[model samples]
Target: MTTFLQLHLLTAYPPSNPNRDDQGRPKQATVGGAPRLRLSSQSIKRALRVSEPFRQGLAGHMGQRTKLMAKVLLDRLLAGGMDAAQARTKAEEIAKVFGKIEPQDKKRPEAVQGTTLAFISPDERAFALDLADKALAGEALPTDKELARTVLRTADGAVDIAMFGRMLADNPDFNRDAAVQISHAITTHRAQAEDDYFTAVDDLQRREDTGGAHLGEHGFGSGVYYLYACVNCDLLVENLGGDKELAARGLRSLVRAIATATPSGKQNSHAHHPRAGYVRAEIGGAAPRDLTGAFFTPVRGDDLFDASARALERTAADIDRAYGPAADAVETMDVPKGQGTLAAIEDFAASALERQNA
Candidate 1:
């Protein structure tokens, strides 16, 4: 049985803020009149990393690396005897077939030396050409070109499915739905309060305008979290078993999987917000201070191992607690014997908390 599971997280921001605001004060908020640690976008991103299938999967395994698109094309074109300018032009055409390229620089020219490419859109053609110049100079190819191809082929379909495959291979039975739920929980755990207080442009000419607030109610707080998840139901059914009851039990696992965090950086680097959220730690009666600095935290080698352990323990427990009753309730549903078994399993899952309580 692929009983082992885990979710790893790297804070999107620094742990705490070192700088203070004007009047030597740090930003803070009171939750229930008690200090709720101010959280940064990094903190939420890290917490959600383990549960996000796309991120978690790509983190450990090889992804569809387009970094070599330009290099590969360049080499092929050169082999066919094309000049640097002609090579880039032809290579660019081939690249379009695969994916869009970005913009290039004019003033600061890039050295079009070796096979090099940067993944970009049509609008970013300029950047793509610029990066290609550097790529050519180094004559370096992406380390895992083949691996990237394999993943990208699938990305062409349900991108999350390929992503989930990688995540499942690493986590076994991990599913996309579960990962999403977890992300939602982490994201909604605490909402930021808008700073609606009026700013005193001048004491006598105070205006009724919000000050130092984020966009959309709270700046840097509200926005779509472009989440990517992949789920392998077959893998899940295998671990859980063909028995309807057993399959039903899998729902809990699914929920937990969705709740796990996905890693950041690399493929996931651009997944989160430029500025996510943060958590502040306060000492004594002092105000809360922001902890995170960056948008996402990079996973360390040690974190890879620790993340698995943590994901398994939490996901397993979450499944058991979240699915028991749901599984039992499945029995009440109208269905054939085999189907009923599945229903029972689902019902039992509904009472997941009861099982954990037991």
Candidate 2:
């Protein structure tokens, strides 16, 4: 049996484009013929990874998802009293192990960027930098294979790397497969794009200058989103090098972030700092299931936020009743006002996850 951890969350966002389409409107998808607002899985994951609570949980055990590999390496070398020009050159060689370098200057001066943001942890970067320093000092360096092993090895691939995984195109052998799956969040009801038309008055505007100095329109919308994510605990542990304890801790942090982190889109205007009004947690060795079917017919109500959450809860109950319980342990955190609190949900999830490894 494969252990799985799953969450169904309902979050309400105001008239703001947290996730936008190419046209700058709230992202939307046609669901069952009705257009529904959407927040992409990529956006949601990035937000959670950078959230304050999530970062605090992982502490310094985090990877830098940046293209600035040369800069990172050069910083280390320069700190060790190496000359700037030499450090830049060596950094390029070291960075080549990870991916292609996009030198900042067309003249190929010094600074370089990785092909993409390679998700390498701080320790891994340090190791690679040290290896470069040794090579520069005429010290005997390890073979290429041994050097790759030394640089790629880690305690747990850092928190973000373990959960989201990384793909080093330069060396596919070091790639870590992601054990967590995220479903793009979609609203439970139809939503239409709305535009906010406004004008900004220039401080030096004269009374004869008429209405305003600048006028433009911004797009936004509101919806109650149904978000889902699944974590294969066994695979996650394997991804973290068979550390079940660390995997469990990572699961808890992930759940907490999922419940609280809102993508920092146009927050100054929308201010969408929403927590899940409801979360249904399922922990089992059974196959994970998503309750997106609950909104196939669209839930309509005067109070859509509460209605959306209620609809999800009803669907989960209906499925369990008909399918004879699809999970080993299931818990629902009804976090609407007096029903429960976010803290309570986090506690419930943590306790339940702890039981899985035990």
lDDT of 1 at 101: 48
lDDT of 1 by residue, 221-270 (tens): 22112121222333333322233233333344333333333233222312
Please give each candidate's TM-score: 0.29, 0.91
TM-score, prediction 2:
0.91
Instruction: Give RMSD (Å) of candidate 1 vs. truth.
Output: 18.4
Q: Which has the greatest TM-score? A: 2
Model 2 error, position 308 (Å): 1.7
Model 1 regions lying over 4 Å from their true place? 1-61, 65-68, 75-82, 108-161, 164-182, 185-358
Best by lDDT: 2
Error of 2 at 117 (Å): 1.4
Q: How close is candidate 1 to the true structure, as a TM-score?
A: 0.29
